[model samples]
Target chain A: MTSRRIESFVGHGALILGALIALYPFVSIVRHALGPAAGSNAAGPFTLENFTRAWVGGGFSHSLVSSAIVAVGVVVVTGAIASLAGYAMAMLDVPWRGAIMGVLLIGLVLPAEARIVPLYDMFEGWGLLNTYWAIILPQIASSFSLSTMWMTTYYSALPKELTESAAVDGANSWKAFTRIVFPLGSSALATLSCLIFLYTWNEFLLALVLLPQNPAVQTAPLSLSFFAGAERNTQPEVIAAAAVLVALPVVIAYAFLQRRFIQGLTEGAVKG
Target chain B: MSLGHRDVAAPEKRRVAGRALRSRPATRRAHRLRTTAWLYLLPGFAFYGAFSLWPLIETFQYSFYKWDGITAAKWVGLKNYIKIFTSEDALSTFAHAFTFILFYAAIPVVVGLVIVGVMTRVRIRLLGLLRTVLFIPQILAMVVVAVAWRWIYAESGPINAALEAIGLDSWTRAWLGDFKTALPAVGLIGTWVMYGLCMVLFIGGSQKIPRDLYEAAKLDGAGPFQEFMAVTLPGLRGEISVALILTVTAALRNFDIVWNTTSGGPGNATLIPSYLIFEGAFVTRQVGYAAAASVVLTTLILLLTGGIQALLRQRK
Candidate 1:
């Protein structure tokens, strides 16, 4: 009993230490962001000046708005399309289903880096560079495969009787989907939306390349890097403040919807 | 709810007319189902093809041509592929990605196993809170993570301050800025980002294992470590494969962290293939070369993940 008790103590000790280490960087960021401007030691007087400076200097107000539009656009578009595709794959009898499934699997595995060069060219050809569509369109494309896969898995796991009963009552596929399947899919939709939002908000490289000279279209994360670069010689607090500002919304969303976020990400992995 | 019921019932009114018109109602129903499925698939596939599939095909096509973003393209088959293989810098960048697997995949899995092992043996309180805390890094923007870690590794940053406090003042240096330590330092940041994911996966996997197996191992006189080796390890094969595939891909395609932290600097110590692709396409305007590098990188990722999947399947 004593040995077991001692083991539990050690395990708790290790877990606590690991947790603190995991959280320390965020703590440090908050400290530096809120603390005085001069030193790395976060013990000096606290001030809102760093945040205000970062807000104005980073041009984050505009970038944050851009990020919101992109994130929301990706989520809405990806979620709607993915859910439809998922419903088809899960509930309907489509010919060439295996080939479609294979395509989606390939799409899921293809890294964004692989297609980025040609995407830039393609978007440029379409005259979409520096436009919200450039970012939103690609993000939706990349996220669509996983989102569809997720919803397919979700729909497959759901009881078939729900849709079947509706179908038996002479309801068409579309009516059954809207009246029956869609209501039951609220959680899945929420999960997909959260995942898409997170991906779109955190995307940096695409925004950087596509919106190169346009601060108005630059995502918050991309803008934060430029902000930090411009102020490399300045106080660390300012940079920390900007970092916090860029990360704030997603962090807040995660805190509130952590269950959905975790479930969506891990479930995607399991399904894949 | 009433509206849903009415909608559901409304379709029944059309059933008599359809039944009276079609002698082969079953075939017609099947056709309708197929049509509906196709309709549902069209919008998703349209966006996917226009953006992802077409771009991927275009990347492969671009690899055979010599074209800047602006100038007219000249077809140069196999030249870009040959260059990617022959170029010393390109080779180093690929090598660096393999090195990152150590930090991104191996270390995190090991640490995750240890943590999960401990948690299974000794139940931890507030497990959800612990998970949330550890996972914060995974959720944060890579740029923000890089910025935070940059400050943490700065000359006057917290790490040096701690070292000075501990009388290891001589050990203090600009970690990311140092060539010798830059790659490993940046890779360790990946370790930090990924370990939570590994832990979460393993913990979830471990919970699915039947408890009786552990009890049976104990009854057979196995100690904790022995039980873990005999029971837990084999049980986690699927999760381990998933974790490996995810982390290895992250390691190989690691651009954002390297870009934000070191910018593949300190004498090319941390340049990964993705960064090279970006630099080639955007900075140096070597579009074909970048496309080749991308193709190679994608192949490498597929091979690694496919290899892991094959290994796990054989074990199963």
Candidate 2:
């Protein structure tokens, strides 16, 4: 009985310790974001002035717009394209299913850092520098794997005889797929779409490389980089507030789609 | 939700609409299908072809040339590649990246699995709340996390003050500035953020193991450790592989955190390949050399991930 009590005590102690480490950074960020307005306290006086200054005319507004443009572009173009490619792989007995999988999975391994320079060269050649498309186009491809992989899994689980029946009814393959496969894949699509939106919204590296230096075209994070003019003012509180603004949309979004988002990520482990 | 239920209702609509569509001509429908498929696919294809695939190929092409990105190109095939291969500084940057991974890969994956394993054994009242709190770091910007940590790691920061009180003042240093410790310091924070993700995956995967296996292990006088080895570990193979693959990839591409924190400072002690690539291309305008470096980096990731996939498939 004494040993069992000791074990329980150790277990609970560890859990509490782990929990505190996890929560500490968040508390720190919050503390810093609303640092005290006056008096020389390094930890601070606790005010909202930092947040207000960061949000109002503080140049994050441009990042908001740029990030939106790129994210929406990803959802509409990349999301839709991946659905089609996924549909093809899941349903059609194409001669190259394995090859297509290999191609997409190749992207799974290739990090943006490896390709950033090449992308810069291509965009410059095409005179696409400082344009929304430069950032949007690359991000769409990066997000393709998430969409295609999930959609294919969703589509394959669907009963095949339905499409076969539609074909017999002379609806042909496309009609059958649209009227049959697409509707069946909606739940999976919703889950995948939510993830894609969040990923493109949160993406940083590619945006920094591809977008223009112009204030209007720069993303929220990139704007934040140049905001204090690169290591001058050193306002950690204002930076945290700006960071909070950048993360706000995705946080609200995940709350709504929490179930599906978790499912999509854990699919390899649990569901599949 | 009604949406999930709506999907369950879709098959019935297909069934009802089937007979009426049969009266349509076959070839005409096939033609329409072709057009629709192409139409649905064309835009995405163009976008990826223009932006992603072409640039990948172009990276190889650019690596062979000496171009200032604006001026006319000069062909110097394989020279840039050879230089990077021979350069001590460039080689050390990769060594730095891999050294950081010692903390990033091993620690995060271990901590994550431990948390998940513990959660399974315990009946925590606020399990869901715990999961959400752990995941907060993944969503927060790297800049905020780095900035917050910078303060903590400062000489007079709370962390050092506490250490001094505990008679461990000798252990303190400017973590982000100290050449010896900077990479590990940044890497540890990454491990912290990532373990939460791993925990989340493991919890989902563990629930799927049949309860009978555990019960059988219990009847055989097996402790939780033995039972986990017999049941939990095997069942968790897929999640473990996924976590390893994802974490390793993130480690190789370690940029934003290190960028925000050190920027490869203290005399290039923290320089990783990504930082070097950024300097070569954007900052220095040695676009060609950066392209060569990028190709090498991409190839290394491909080989590593490929080896992992092979190992996982072989185990299966």
Output the worst ten-in-a-row residue range by lDDT, candidate 2 chain B: B1-10
lDDT, candidate 2, A1-272, per-residue tens: 56545555665565566667877876776776777533434453677777777877567776788888877877887667877877766665444457657666756566887678777767778998778978887888777766677777878788666776676677755676678888888777787777777667767677777774767788776666555436324566677677667767777776676676566555622221
Instruction: Rate residue A130 of model 2 by lDDT.
Output: 79
Would you give me the overall lDDT of model 2? 0.71
Residue-wise lDDT of candidate 2 within B1-316, one digit each (tens)?
0111122446577545553555557435544544554554556567666666777888888889998878898999899999898999999888987876666777877876676555555545555766676666666666556666766677767788988999998998888789888877888877876777787777767877777887888899988678778888878877777777777777877887777777788788888888888898998998889888888888887787667666765253
- lDDT by residue (B1-316, candidate 1, tens digit) is 1112223344576555555655586656657667878999999999999889998998999889887878898999999999989989889999999999999999999988997786677666877987788778878999999999999899988889999999998899999999888999999999999988888888888888899998899999998899889999899999999899889999998888998989898989998899988988998998988998889999888888889988886353
TM-score quality measure for candidate 1: 0.94
Candidate 2 off by > 4 Å: A1-16, A38-45, A228-233, A268-272, B1-40, B117-124, B165-170, B219-221, B314-316
Candidate 1, residue B310: how far the Cα is off, in Å: 2.2
Best candidate (score: lDDT): 1
**Residues A94-138 of candidate 1: C-alpha lDDT, one tens digit per residue:** 789889988987777788888999888888888989999889999
Candidate 1: how many backbone clashes? Answer: 0
Model 1: lDDT to the true structure:
0.86
* Cα misplacement distance, residue B39 of candidate 1 (Å): 0.7
Backbone clash tally (model 2):
3
